[model samples]
Target chain A: MPSFDLDSYLQTQVERVEQLLRSRSDEMGVQVPPRLLESMRYSLLAGGKRLRPVLCLAFAEAVLKQSNVPRMVEDCACALEFIHTYSLVHDDLPSMDNDDMRRGRPTNHKVYGEAMAILAGDSLLTDAFALVAGGPEPVRGVLCRELAVASGSSGMVGGQVLDIAEDRPAHIDYLTRMHRLKTGALIRAACRMGVLAAGGDADALARADVYGDSVGLAFQIADDVLDVTGDASSMGKPVGADAAAGRFTFPAVLGLEESKQLAARKVAEAIDAVKTLEPHDGPLAALARYSVERRS
Target chain B: MPSFDLDSYLQTQVERVEQLLRSRSDEMGVQVPPRLLESMRYSLLAGGKRLRPVLCLAFAEAVLKQSNVPRMVEDCACALEFIHTYSLVHDDLPSMDNDDMRRGRPTNHKVYGEAMAILAGDSLLTDAFALVAGGPEPVRGVLCRELAVASGSSGMVGGQVLDIAEDRPAHIDYLTRMHRLKTGALIRAACRMGVLAAGGDADALARADVYGDSVGLAFQIADDVLDVTGDASSMGKPVGADAAAGRFTFPAVLGLEESKQLAARKVAEAIDAVKTLEPHDGPLAALARYSVERRS
Candidate 1:
């Protein structure tokens, strides 16, 4: 098969995600209070790379070898985006990261007040389960369990706890574990959910796990590198805020060159991990490469 | 049949719930940062009425006429408490109600700092779904869907948004709707889930809904009354907090006497709603009356 067009595939998937998210936001407006819905919609619709959901959809395609993404797969992808967005909203709260801006716009708490921001985050998190539970019956339990485990205490939230507790760099092992739970967990879940959606077997699930873990770590390291080198105009947030906040980042723990080399190695591992799903795995391979190569 | 001892039943059920919660908290401690788990346990195990879980267990018994609570039923009860605790933690955030004390102890944020407190809340909410998803396969989807809808944007969170929006008393209809979604949704879910867990039919579920809705409203109205008349020591927190916050409470919207009368009528209706369950529903019936009678 011809080499995959990574840009084209991502653009198509992103548009699909935006449309689903927009319709869901409109539905929420009718059901919830205007300002509350506005706060939720404000952050959710604010455009980002839609990277997690894209990976979910791409993985489903690779595993199923199907041209059309199933409705359940799309819904699961949307759920991933919602979970990611909610985490960002809560992470940007005044008490958390205290981030004033995100995705080139005022953060959720900045746009709506702190109370509404917190509620908006709660709503998004709850609604994500509602979305996944709407998937096909056979996989609903698995999907819900995966997403919850990936996003819950021992996963994303646990990582954030460690991140906040980091007064000083303790050890490289600690930082690696923190990033794996904080960012890697959900990224890993996105791929795993895709495999589940496509009814992939245990072997396929294991392969997806390997692919996700490598890419998730590579993605975070790349983010650290970008914090050191990327422009704010494209990244849509301050570049050096992590350093200013005394964050223990990849580049901080490892020198810039070393971090870059590590990210490159992880990306290569991610590509290799998905080889079993080849020729349909081109997009997944491209995403792994993009994890390190993207400025944002 | 002999009359059910409501106090004894509640005492036993509450103990069981406490044991489950303690074990779960211990599990979280092992998996997460100590401080994060500490923040969660501080609020979750701080001890309140445990009314929601009791109501859930009672309804399950009413529907199934069982002598002992099943493991799934117990798990569902724990999930309810977890969700309730998370809401309280987030509600106590400085940006939210900003209360310093809860259950006569310092609030989670006060003890853990704002960031850890927020994460603790997120963890609880996420963990609740994880718990429910672990339920029996046949009803796992339904349990997850029901809990998600009742606690999500259009339910409890929506009520909160409305609560914060109310600068003064809105129309009675609006206030009623807000309270129903806010406190009423989860109470209703607690009962509804009980029936679902027992594999009850539509009729059983309808009865649970009616019982939950009436008692939930009565419970909130009674809470409004206690805010005016109860002592802080007995209430485990300051009295008159609602009024001090300028919250549009039931007692504030309606005069004190009117609120008291409404709560009495709601309690009566709640008791009457579960009449179909006959002798088996004695605890549920007594619990409805207790909703308005309790000082805290």
Candidate 2:
């Protein structure tokens, strides 16, 4: 009867993710060197939108038509977050993006030395598998495969390579392909993993896959738009760095107006795809809209 | 009727691992960017002893008492090699060990650039899980857990942190613990994963564990001895770099004679532990001896 307040939903879910990450770090065992653990916790616990984990949990809830999803869903969500954090840590390294600031604070390498940051990222990536491997059988292997395939050379890492390539073509198709692999792959995995974790049927999984594809592209377009138009304070990192570095983004490839229109259309597709899974004005629809409308 | 020839056994296993690595890279999908795939293949196909994969396959054969292990065993073996290769790539990074050469060739970064090399290492690590996750259901999860835990924060990465720590204690216990995690964990996993993939019983797994622990320690001590006494051409990498960097190695902590004695003792322990798992003069015992006798 009441309206589904997306803000409150996100806050509650973010808190849950934070708690899980904290507990998981604590449970990493006494044998985990203190400094390595500290470096890992620093970026892992650093505040972000928690987009991947939230999307994973949301899909699970929507598929089950209930809020109380299984522990497998939580495990999948945590693994997604861990993978996301590791990517960020590595992407921000001096040899990569050379990012000095992230999430309104100094990057991992700035706080911990570059070597420790690399190890922290490595530990996070490895530990994500450890966490998912502990999930209940049948689905656990699926979860591991999903997470790995989405993040490995053919996916996120592939996207990174394209992004940094000196001879990349400047075309909308190339841009789309790059984003699809880099950011879209993991986002899609998050949604699909949620469905798998909740034992959703084939139809549900297919719908989730469609919804994820749309939202993932939309999210990257929105990110490109924000880099051009949004303020640095809200984003926690400098704006326009992508353009300055001559990075191929939607706004750069297409006109700003065209990019915005494409994002809006993609969001609409995302919402329509998830209609069977949730009500018209449900969190899924709201999230699609938020993908483009969010300031940071 | 023929003697267990360690040389021929290693050559045959190494070839199998190399073939798998090549095929796996080819099948990573065309969606994978060319540069990323090239970088990944560079270090992955680069010749080493293929020790981890060979060890994994050997244990699987020893447990099954046949040369024809399952596809799962091969998959786990490749995964182990992938992890080992990734660790080497990262360890050779400028921010980490800063080595310009590895396996008698230019390091990954030298060929592919630093950013590409990092991504290559990352892709290798993530794809390792993907490889194992494709194994048969229940055992796949266990394989994932074993590989992850052995290579994660509480294992190899943790050991790396200790190795690089500025204030690390200079004691035998500290050195042992560091090696136990960094090198020993993956070696132990190599043995255990082989047994699991072969569907060996718990007792077999336990024996593999003991054998792994002893050989792992012996391997490190031998490595330390090699660094101090072995030739660079034979070892592929420069010798005495560890001592030059003031690394806490066996030869540095204990005297050279004491380190050699300790290695011999560990090799004896390793051979003794595996007597129940393999014939008295089997490949397992030969491998234990090889752990100390190898030039590289």
Candidate 3:
């Protein structure tokens, strides 16, 4: 089998997700105040890897085994991106990471003021549900449940609290748990939601779940590794910001070499989990490898 | 035929909503970090009128014409309260209204610090979707859409931005538009969601919409009037606080007497709109009057 062109796949998928994110909010008939909408669009349109939505689209295509996926998948993909973007906006706030820079640009709060930034994050998060809930019936509710549970208190938000707790332990188990919830949950939801949106069967869903879990963990470990080893310019943010903030990270608790090994192992597991759909190197497999390979 | 006991109805419904909110998060299987849960409960269970949830329940009962409402209505009612509580938490943030007190207690940020307060608010908002999505099918998606639309960017958050806009006009139209999106949108959602959950048809929904709009505006105008004339102890926050903050209030723009008169007219209109539900002074009618007549 021919090797998949991972760069071309990512670029195509990213552009698709970007277009939907840019226009879907207007299509939904929801009214946002002008300045508030500006604040939301500023952060939302500020570029990223678009990883979650790309994963969602990839999963949908893989499950359908076709080029054209359903509109439901498209909506869920956009919703996943919105959720991911809102987290970034809130995480960069003055009360959270107090980040001044993100994605090679000024952070949302830095550019829009803390209040507008907070509201922007709030709007993005709320509108995500609007997007998912607007999808086709039955699966729409399931998607909402998946997105909410993954991103809500027990999922991403819970992980955030753990990350910020002063008394939190710096052990590997604690770090893994925090990362699993903080970043892992939403990524898993993104993959699973795509399958659900595509009307995939239970077996397909279970496989997607496993692939999501492995890739999600690998992505975070790679993030931690990048924070330690990558250059600031390539990474778009300071290389050691996490360590400087005393954040509990994989490299901090498990050493740099061990973290790299764990990420590689997770990538292998992710690739293996998706082997049924694509025996040879496929987009999913390449994405798993790229999760660790990417500099930022 | 007789005067509805507004106080008793409020007490019974508020207690039911309070109980549901206190326990529903656990029932939803959404895991909240302990401290984060406490921070959310600190403001959520701090005890306001529980007006939004109560309105939801009342509408559900009115539409069903029975004592027992569906569990879906209960879930949505709790979801409405969750959204309202979250808005209050965010609104009181240091970067926003900077209110040190709410409902006679130190505000969320004052108790949990700014970061936890923000997370608590985020959790509440996200978990509200969780609750709605966990409800019975078809209607579950509809309920999620309604809740999200009413509370998202164009709804409540949009209104907050308008309220805080530096160049916002002090006219009554601006105040009305701002409140309609902010407090009005969610309150309207509470009423419409109850009807939707109960399987009420278009006419029922339209009536609820009218009732919601009229009552929502009246409530805000009365609130503005209270800010001018009510005592701090009774109100649970300082009287004249809104005016002191240079907020554009109905009373400030229309004068106290005119504001009171406008609220009365709105209350009358709300009661009239809901007459089909209970021809005489029903719970809905009494609640409309209470919008303007209440001391706090």
iRMS for model 2? 1.0
- Of 1 and 3, the candidate ranking higher by lDDT: 3
The DockQ scores of all candidates, in the order shown, are 0.81, 0.85, 0.80
Candidate 3 docking DockQ: 0.80
Question: Model 2 reproduces what portion of true contacts?
Answer: 0.91
Reference-based lDDT, each prediction: 0.88, 0.91, 0.89
**How many clashes does the backbone of model 3 have?**
1
Question: Which segments of model 2 are wrong by more than 4 Å?
Answer: A1-3, B1-3
- Over the full model, what C-alpha lDDT does candidate 1 score relative to the true structure? 0.88
TM-score of each: 0.97, 0.98, 0.98
Considering summed lDDT, which 10 consecutive residues are worst modelled in model 1 chain B? B164-173
What lDDT tens digits, residue by residue, belong to model 2 across residues A31-124? 7999999999999999898888999999999989998998889988988989999999999999999999999999999999999999999999
| Every prediction: chain A TM-score | 0.96, 0.97, 0.97
Best by DockQ: 2
**Candidate 1 backbone overlaps, count:** 0
- Residue A207, model 2: lDDT of 87
Model 3 lDDT per residue over A67-129, tens place: 699989999988888888899999999888888998999998888899999999999999999
CAPRI quality of model 2: high
- Candidate 2 chain B has its poorest 10 consecutive residues by lDDT at B24-33
Clashing pairs in 2: none
| Docking quality category of candidate 1 according to DockQ thresholds | high
